[model samples]
Target: MAQFDVEAFVDRQKIGRPQLAVLLVCLLVCFIDGFDIFMVGKIAPAIAEGFGEPVEAMTLLFLCQQIGLAVGAFVVAPLADRFGRRSMLIFACATFGAVTLASVYAQTLFQLSIMRGIAGVFMSAGLPMALAMISEATPRHRRSTFIAIALAGYSTGSAASGAVAAWLIDIYGWQSGFWIGGIVPILCIPLLLFFVPESLKYRTERNPKDPGIARTIQRMDRSVVLAGDEVFVLGEADGTARKAKLLDVFLEGRTWMTSILWAACFLSMANIALLAAWLPSFFQEMAGIPIQRFAIIALIAYGGGVVGTLTIGYLMDRIRATTLIPFYYIGISVALFAMGQVSFEAPIFIGILLFWSFAQTGGQGGLNTLITQVYPPRMRSTALGWSGGAGRIGGVISPIFGGVAIAQNFSLQLTLTCIAVVPLIVAVLVFMLGRNSYARQAVIASVVTQRGTA
Candidate 1:
C-alpha cells in the first residue's frame, strides 16, 4: 500500500493558485467580521438619536455584545474541532450576516442589543477559524506572513466602518453601515463555499480514507498522483488521530506554555480595550484637544496599525518570534510611557501615537500568529478560541477599569502610566513563552534527527 506524508508535502510546496484562493477568501471573512464587530461603536450616537435615548443607554448593548463574543470564543469556536473549520466558518458567516441585517430594523436599543449580541456569537468565530484555515494551508516558512496578511483585512474593515459611517450614516441613516457590513458577508458565502478548500491536514488527521484528500492534493499540485487505497499521514510523532478535547490544550506538557499565553493575551487585550474605550475622551477632556483634531489623529494612527500589522508579519517570517514578538510589546510600553510625558501639541506626539498603534495593534496580531504556531491541528482551534476567550475577559474588564479611573477624575499621566504597566507584563510573559517554545522545538528536532539516524 502506498503511503504519503501530507504535512511534509504541504510544507515543501510553494505558494500556488490554490493557496492564494484560500488566503483571499479567509481575508474576506476577516474583513466582514471586523466590520460587524466595530460597526456598533461607530454608529452608536446615530442609533441613540434614532431611538430617543442617551448615548449612555448603549452601554448595555456594548456589554451584551462583548459577553456574546466571550461566549462565542469559548463555546462556539471550538465546535470547529469536531465539525470542520470550513463548515463552521460558513455557518458563522451566514448567520452573523443575517442577524446583523435584521438589526437595522430594531425599534429600540434593547432589541438592537439582542440582535447584536446574537450576531457577536457568530461573528466571534470568523477570525480564529479563518486563521486556523490559513495557517494549516500555507507553507510553514510563510505561515506567519500569510496569517498577518489575512488579519490586515480585519483592521482594514474596522477602519472602513468609520469611513462608511462618515459617508453613509448622515445621508442614509445609521442603517447604511449595517447594510454594507451585512450584505457583503452574505454575498461572500457563495465565494467561500465554492473557492475555499477544507484544511487538508484536518482531513488526513480526522479521516484519512476520505477520497477528497486525493483530489485536494491534486488541485494543490497536479503533478502528484494518489491512488485510492493509499494511507495518508501527518507524520508527527505527537499527532495521533483522536477526538479533540478542550483539556488537550493543557495536556502534552503545555500547561505552563498555555498559562503564559493566556496571561499575555489577557494583559495585552486589557490595555487595548482600555485605550479603545477611553482614549478619545482622555485626549479631549484632559489634554484639551478638540474632538475633531483627535479624530484626525486617530485616523492617522490607524494607518500606523496597518503598517505595523504587515511589518510584524513579514518580520516574524524571517526573525525568531520569541525575540520579535516581545520586542513589539516592549515598544508598546515605551510608547505608552512617552505619551504620558509628551506634549500633545508637539509633532512628536503624532509619531508616538503612530508607534503606539503600530506596536499595540501589531503586537496583538503577533500573539494570534504565535498561538497558531504553538498548537497542533487537532486542538488548534480550541487553543485559539480559549486563549482569545481569556483575552475577551480582559477586554471586558479594562473598559470598566478605565471608567472607574475617569469617574475618579484621575490625571492623564497617572492613568496612562498605569496602563503602560500592562504591556511590560505582557512582554515578560511572551518572553518566557518564547523560551519554552524554543526549547520544545529543539527537543522535537533532536528526536526527529535521532529517529532518522536510527
Candidate 2:
C-alpha cells in the first residue's frame, strides 16, 4: 500500500517562478475584467443621470458589451489555438486597456456605448487565453487546482471592483471607473512583457503536434501504466504526445461528450454572467438599497461564490468531476428560485444570496475544471472560452430582460422567479450531459484496454 504524495503530484507541472508570474499577470488581467464588467452596473444609475437617459437604455449598453464578448469568444478564441496563447493574451489586455481609457473621453451615449463594446470585445479574449496558458503551464493532475486558484482572482477582482467603484464613483464620477479599468491593464503590460513567458506547450513549428504531443503521450504511458496501480497522473506533460485539434474533440473519441460539456459550459457560465451583470442593480432597485449597501450585498454574493468554488474543488479531487456538477446546478436553481421569493428579512435574503452565489459562481468554476480535463490540451482553452463566450450571450440577455421586467412593472417576485427557471433548465441539461461524460469516459477506458490486450 502506497500513500499519495501531493507535492510530487503538483510539482510535475513545473510551476516555478515564471509560471507563477504568469498566474499573477492573469490575476491582474481578470481584475480588470471584474472591475469593468461590474463597473457598468455600479455606475448604471449615474450614467442614466449623466446622459438623462432611462435605465432601459443603459440595459441595452450592457447587452451590447456582452454581445461583443460573445463574438470575441467564438471568433477570437480559436485564433489563440491557431497562433499562440501569450501573444493573444498580451494583445488582448493592452487593447482592452487602451480602448477603455479612450472611453473616458467620450461625451455622448453613442460614444460610450461603442467604446464599451470595443472594450468588451478585447477584454473577452483575456479570460480564455489566461485559462489556456495556466492549463498548459501547470502539470495535468494539478491543472484544475491551479485553474481554480487563478479564477479566484476573477472573484477577488469582482469584490474589489465593488469597493473601488463605491469609493471612486463619489470622487471621480462614472468615467473614473473606466479610467481605473484601463490603467490597471496598462500596468500589467510591463509584467506581461518581462515576466510572462510564452506557454511551454504552445507550438511555434509548422507541425505543432510533432514533439510536443508525442512527448506528452509518452509521459502519460509512464505515469498511468508503467507506474503500476499508482494512478501516477501527469499534471503538466506526460511522455506521450497526442496530436490535438478542435475537430478531434468530436471526431476522434469523445465528440458527443465534448458537445455535452460545451453545453454545460454555456449553462454554468450564463448563470454567473447573468448575476454578475444584474444582481447589484436588482438589489438596489427592487430591494431599495443604497449603492454602498448594495455593493456590500454584492460582496456577500461573491463571498458565497468563493465558498462554492472551493467546495467544488474539494469535491472534484475526491469524486468524479462530471458526477458532482449536476448537483451544484440543482442547488443553484433552487437557491435562485428562493432568491426570487425572499424578502428583505436578513436571514432569508442572506441564505438566498449565498445559495445563488455558490450554485452559480462555484458551479461555474467546477464546470470550467471539468471542461479543461475532458478536452486535450490543444483545444481546451478555445472550448472553455467559446463556451463561456456563448454563455456571455445569456449574461447579456438576462440583465436586459431583468431591466425590461422591472420597467414594465412586472412584479419583482415574478421576474426573479422566472430567472430561476433558467438555472433549473440548465441543471437538467448539465445533468444529462454529466451522464454522457461519464459514459464517454467509460467507453474510452474500455477501448484503451481492448487495444492494450490486442
Candidate 3:
C-alpha cells in the first residue's frame, strides 16, 4: 500500500464497536449538558418562591448563563485544536459540575446568577467537543444519522429534568435538583478521563507519528490493510496546517455559509430559549394547570424533537439543507401560530406544541449536521462553537424579553405570534442561502471522491 488516507478511510468504512462506544459517550455528555441547561428553567418557580422573589427577578440568571455560553463558545472552543477535544471536554465538565454543586448553597439570587454564569462558561464546550468527536469517528454517509441519535440524548435529558423536578421539587425543594445535576457530572469525570476517546483528527494533527492514528483507523474498520512502512492522510488532515485560528471559519469560500448559519442559529436558539424559559409559566398561568404538569407539556415538545431530529437528519442526507431548513422554519412558524390559537385543553395545546418542536427543534439538529459537512475538520469545532455562541446571544436576551413581555402583561397569544415572526425571517435568510448553496451534496461527495481509490 502507498499510504492511508484517514478521512477517506473513515468515510468509506463501516462503524464498529469503538465508534459505537464513542457515540454513546458523546451522547451521554451532551445529554447531561442538556439536562443542566434545562434544569434551571424547570425549577425557576420553585427557586423564585424559595428566595421570596418574583419570577422576573430570576431573569438575570438566564441572561448570565447565556452570556457565559457565548464567551466560552466564542473564546474557548477553538482551544480544542491545540489542547485536544478530550482534554477540553473533561475540564469543562468538571468545572461546570463543581460550580453546579456549589450553587446548591447559593443564599441569594445574585449568588445563584453568578454560579449559573460560571456553569455556562464550561457548559458551552460540551456540544462543540462532543459533535467534533462524533463527526470524526463516524463514517460520512452515516454522520447525520448518528449525530441525530447522539443529540437525541440531549432532548431526552431535557425532558427528564421536568419529570424529575415534578417528582422531587415539592419534597426536597430547588436544592434537590441542583444536587442531582451536580453530583452525576462529577461522577462522570473519571469515566470521561478513562474511557472517552480523543478525536482521530486531533491526534493525527498533533503528531502524525502518533501510534493512535493506526489504531483509530483500525477502529473505524477491521478490513483495511496498511502494508506500507508509513501511513499518512492526503489533504487538510495531513497534519501540516495550523487549526487554532478562528478566522479560518470565514475563509475558503465559507463566508456566506458561516454568516447565514450564524443568523439561523441566533433566531432558532432565541425562540427555543424563550419557549424553554417561559412556557411552563405560561401553561400554569393561562391554562390554570398545576405547575408540575407544565413539565409534561415541555416533555411532549421534546419527545417530538426526537422524531423531528432523526427525520431531518435522514432527509438532509438526500435533500439539500437549503430546501429543508427554510421549509422547516416555515413549518415551525405555522405550527407556533397554530399553538397560539388552540384552546386551553391540555391535549390539544401540547399536540400543536409538539408540531412546533418537531419543526424547530428537529430543524436545529439538521442545521448542526449540515454544518459539519461544510467545514473541514480543522474548522469544525470553532465553526460549531461560534455558531452556538452566536445563537446563545439570543438566549441571553430571550429570558429578559420574556420577563418584559410578562411584566408588561402581554397576552400569551400576542407573545407567541410575535415570536413566530422571528422564524419566518429566518426562512427568508435561509432561502437566500439555499440559492447560494446549490449542489452542496456534490461538494461533500467531492471531498471524499477526491481521495484515491484502493
Runs with alpha carbons beyond 4 Å of true place in candidate 1: 237-240, 437-439, 442-454
Kindly report which residue stretches of model 2 are placed more than 4 angstroms away from their true locations once superposed: 1-15, 48-60, 204-249, 273-296, 340-343, 346-348, 400-417, 437-454
lDDT for 127 (candidate 2)? 79
The candidate with the higher lDDT, 1 or 3, is 1
TM-score of 1: 0.95
- Mark the 10 consecutive residues where model 1 has the least summed lDDT: 445-454
Evaluated with lDDT, which candidate comes out highest? 1
**Which residue pairs in model 1 clash with each other?**
none
- lDDT per model vs. reference: 0.84, 0.67, 0.77
Better of 1 and 2 by lDDT: 1
lDDT of 1 by residue, 20-105 (tens): 98899889988988887888898899989989999999999998999899999999889888888889988998898899899889
User: What value does the lDDT take at residue 371 in candidate 3?
Assistant: 72
**Predictions ranked by lDDT, top down?**
1, 3, 2
TM-score of each: 0.95, 0.79, 0.87
lDDT of 3 by residue, 281-360 (tens): 76566556676766556566767888998888776656666677888889899987787777756467778878888898
- Cα lDDT tens digits, model 2, 82-181, are 6677777777878899999998788877788888888888787787778877766665545556677767778777777677556887888878878788
Q: How many residue pairs clash in each candidate?
A: 0, 19, 0
